[model samples]
Target: MPRSTHRAAPTPPGGLSRRTPDAAVPLRPLGRLHDVASALTALLASDLKEHGLTAPAFHILAVLRRAGPDHRLTTGRLAAIDMVTCSGMTVRADKLEKSGLVVRERDENDRRVVHLRLTERGLRLTDRVLAGLHAREARLTAGFDADELRALAGLADRLERALQHSAGAFRPVPPPH
Candidate 1:
């Protein structure tokens, strides 16, 4: 098997390693974090595939399920919620519509406006997918209790905010309304 990309630097004889540059001190942890995130995402994607869904597609289904059957949202809203391009959301919506998992309707009052809602099939699928995901997440965090989980989430949020401020290229992401 291939070695992990996030190998830690060996401690030198005098506790000063010369293999890595001084600038990489912070980057080492970040790299490890990225590695773990990438691996976890891949695992989640694999799980989704078994359900005949992709991560992006599941995000839409989950969002719709959360919004309830009567509260239909537009493609733009879904795109914003998923942090994806409108075209990306449209493509996912198209696939879901074709699969009979979602229904898209034109506004009765305005022909230009389109709204989306989950079908009965979609509702059931979303429930199963979300439940499985939640269970998988819990298993992945098996060592952590509720308090630890909350603390980890708080720390992660802090890291996200720090990166958002440090990265000039990042646009301001507003709280979901």
Candidate 2:
């Protein structure tokens, strides 16, 4: 008779292995990514705080500034671009509006929808914020050669695309007023 080659699983204290061993292992790549993201977020948040804005608010202003000459973005579109909940985005926009950094206008073609535009002050502030951010980014990337910098940018872009693809199936809500 041939002997059985299968090995018995490790027994638990209670005489049963209720969960798989894989579940006990840490996800290293995810952990590392989270740590890096948190650090970057803190740095950006601190920089934006100096301008009396949060990272999300600064991003909103930047997006409006980069929009076409109309300088307007639909609330839904803004929320999508910012990758935030509609309600959360609405709150950010409200704060910006209160600070005289942005204004909400009713879309002419669609009365029910609102468009957001940066105020003159907002544009000026964004310009300053961008200059400062660019300086910081330059300092951080200074260690990298041109090719390495390009590669980093390309990788970042690809990562963003992958994230978007994964989350694209979820429907975005219209931003609240």
Candidate 3:
């Protein structure tokens, strides 16, 4: 038997360099992340729409739940965590309050500062939403075995660290309409 050999086709003159194919050049990893994020966002948004809430409103409820029984978070801190402007947060808080999902109270120690907290109804709603979210997450992970799931989680953590490092210097802008 004779050995076989393979050679890449030669590049066309004045075309893209052989080192980087115009069509096959490596793409930014962030592109894939963005796609995954957009899909997930759409799924969540659809779910929230049925409950008469937007994603941001759902997030506010979730944050309040995580803050424990007190369910209190400063407006400034919540805005920072939610990646929205102070005015935007105020508007969101106002809507949630009117919807009976949250309440605003003056901080005892800082009279000028307002603290946002979830109402009992808000807590119940959060619990229900979280249960649904957990079920969905489990379904997504159902195909993976324990070891594979662990490996996937580890890879995700590493990728998250890389993204966080790079994100400090990159401010995401809204995609063009």
Highest TM-score scorer? 1
For all predicted structures, in order, the TM-scores are 0.76, 0.68, 0.75
Give the local distance difference test score of model 3.
0.78
Greater TM-score among 2 and 3 belongs to: 3
Considering TM-score, where higher is better, how would the candidates rank from best to worst? 1, 3, 2
Clashing pairs in 1: none
Give one digit per residue, the lDDT tens place, for model 2 in 1-177.
654445346533432432443333333554556666777889999999888988778878888888877678988888888777788789888899999999999988989898999889999999999999899889988899999988978987776667667857543333422
Q: How many clashing residue pairs, candidate 2?
A: 0
Worst 10 residues of 2 by lDDT: 14-23
Alpha-carbon runs more than 4 Å astray in model 1: 1-27, 69-71, 83-85, 169-177
* Cα RMSD for predicted model 3: 9.6
lDDT of 3 by residue, 33-145 (tens): 66667778888888788888898899888887887669889888788878899999999999999999999999889898998988899888888988988898899889999
**C-alpha positional error of residue 99 in candidate 2 after TM-score superposition, expressed in Å:** 0.2
